[model samples]
Target: MRHIKEYDGLRGLMALWVLVGHWAATIYIQFPWPANLGNAYAVDVFVILSGFAIATLVERKRETYGIYITRRVLRIFPVYWFYLAISIALAWVSVDMWTNAAGGEATSNRLQISIAALDNFWPNVISHVVALHGAVPRNMVPNGEYAFLGQAWSISLEWQFYLIAPLVIALGVRAASSFKAGLVLVLGLFVLSYISPRFPYSFIGRYSAFFAIGIATYFLVNVGIPFLTQRRIVIAPIAMLIVTALILLQLPSVLPVSIWIVATASVLVPSQFGLSAIAGLLRWKPVQALGQMSYSVYLSHMAVLVLAMLVLEKAGITSTYLHAALLLIITLAGTLIISIASYNFIEVPFQRLGRNLATRPQAAE
Candidate 1:
């Protein structure tokens, strides 16, 4: 139950990967592979990390269920709602441009943003408020997964997992004592994953295997084989990424599995493994700093990218490469600044508040 600095570093890497993937699309650069595939892979890594983190917290803190859930809600919501407000405002201000873009023949990020903002606005807001927007069936709310804050679908999914994690971990604890039992649990989760597409993309079950992998990782590293502490497992994730990248075009379905494997391996491996490249890179101070504010980076980067694109377009800096370069510079700078402020003001304060409230004594319960 020791704190894992490498997990933070890994989170930082995945967040930046997601940002870069989005940046590629924004700048209209087409890779040989599917453009948004990297983003999806990174998000899957996040799902796995969430599972691992939740397991770690449950095992280490042993807080009451109510207290744990309360802390999680506050951890996720305050900063999320802060950015939600920003996204709504930005959408409102740029509605006309979005509308105009929509009328054009070409599809662009602006048009997509406009559609997400304009369609069933109040309904979307209500669903998002309760963090149930991701569960709404697509037929009920077309493209609801990407509505409003496009990246937030995953946040809702994580919220769902937070609600259920204690129960799952309790079951997992029993299973951890028996290899066959643990295998059954994992198999059950994979079955859920197989059926999850019948529901919304943001449904927790859709990513069940990823979460299961993370949970299994926790059991491996913490409970089952702490003696394997000397094993150099960092190469596993790096190799997974490279192999998956090469084969993804032919085997797109391998993405979820591959990403989960990478993420889970990253957790099982220690960052202080005799100067391995990936492990050492993860332990670097700047990477750790980025990891610290990774949630802010993940949520705020898209908005920064959009705003930078708008400003550059207005300035008529439309040469393709120059525009892309400027957008990258401006967006990265803006995102870091906003994310730092948001982390300090919104995230840190709310997190402290959650801690205080959770630790406060109950009266006559």
Candidate 2:
């Protein structure tokens, strides 16, 4: 129920890591290791953490479903809409720039931007505005690009989870008294994931297992899993090794799901054991602040990356390494500045409004 600053630190780290991963991928700078592993793994971590946070907080507050859902929508949408507007504007700029460059009968790679922009613009805008882009069967944006906000696919998954979290919490409470019942719930999640389609990106199919892990974690912490808590030192390394091996193996099947489950457990269970060093690192003030604005950072970073790339290209910065490095620097700095402003102005205000509405007497009715 109490705020977990450590989780904030973890969120901060994950956000920055995602930014790095995106920067690398966009620039075609290959890491010796698989480029997608860290960022993809981070998304799982986020899903797990989301489940855990929602379950833990809702249970502690005894919040009504109405209040919970309202707060969630308020928390997510204001900043997201702001970013969406920005993305649209940037998309327009990109299109105009590409068109102007093409008018001189010069060939430029920037024309790809205009091509993608022309693909399903209205459909993409509508789907994204309604948060159904990721849930639909077809690509919401042209050429499978999520318009300009490609990273928002995960945001759609998260918003879907927010809609169902109250139900998840209620079911978790019912299952709390029986370990067997808890296992059944987890198994059900696995089954759902197995049956869901790989295309169109069903949230249940893609992320339910990770979400189950978080829910399971909350129960484990509450019920006090002695083996996990008492053997933190030994289990921590083993958990890390297992996750590392899974990432490196890059198995072509469902085995990576196991990696995420273990990965979430690795970070969470050890912290429960009062691993002071880990806690201290995660609770560091600056890290916690970053975590506070992490949502903003995540939403805005890709846009910053796109703008930075365009600027670099126009400036004729052709060296790949230099381009990548400068882009990273600019993206990180820009993301931080934008996140701070959005968090203070847009996110905090909507969050306050949601709290006020939730606490109003009629809200309980």
> Candidate 1 on 210-307: residue-level lDDT in tens?
78767767877775555544563345545456656757666654665564554445545544333346566776898898999999999999788778
lDDT for model 2, on a 0 to 1 scale? 0.71
Worst 10 residues of 1 by lDDT: 98-107
Tens-digit lDDT track of model 2 for 1-365:
24666778888878887888776666645567655436766776777788788778676767788888888889898899899888888887766654543121111333563456457677777877867667665433433335557678788888878887777667677786978667876877777666566445535557776776677667666665555557554455655675567669885423435534443443565454455566677778998899999999999997887787678778988777787689788998999998999999999999999889777866667
TM of each candidate vs. truth: 0.83, 0.79
Give me the runs in candidate 2 sitting further than 4 Å from their true place: 94-117, 139-145, 175-191, 226-275, 362-365
CA error at residue 5 for candidate 2, angstroms: 1.0
Clash pairs (backbone) in predicted model 1: none
Give the clash total for candidate 1. 0
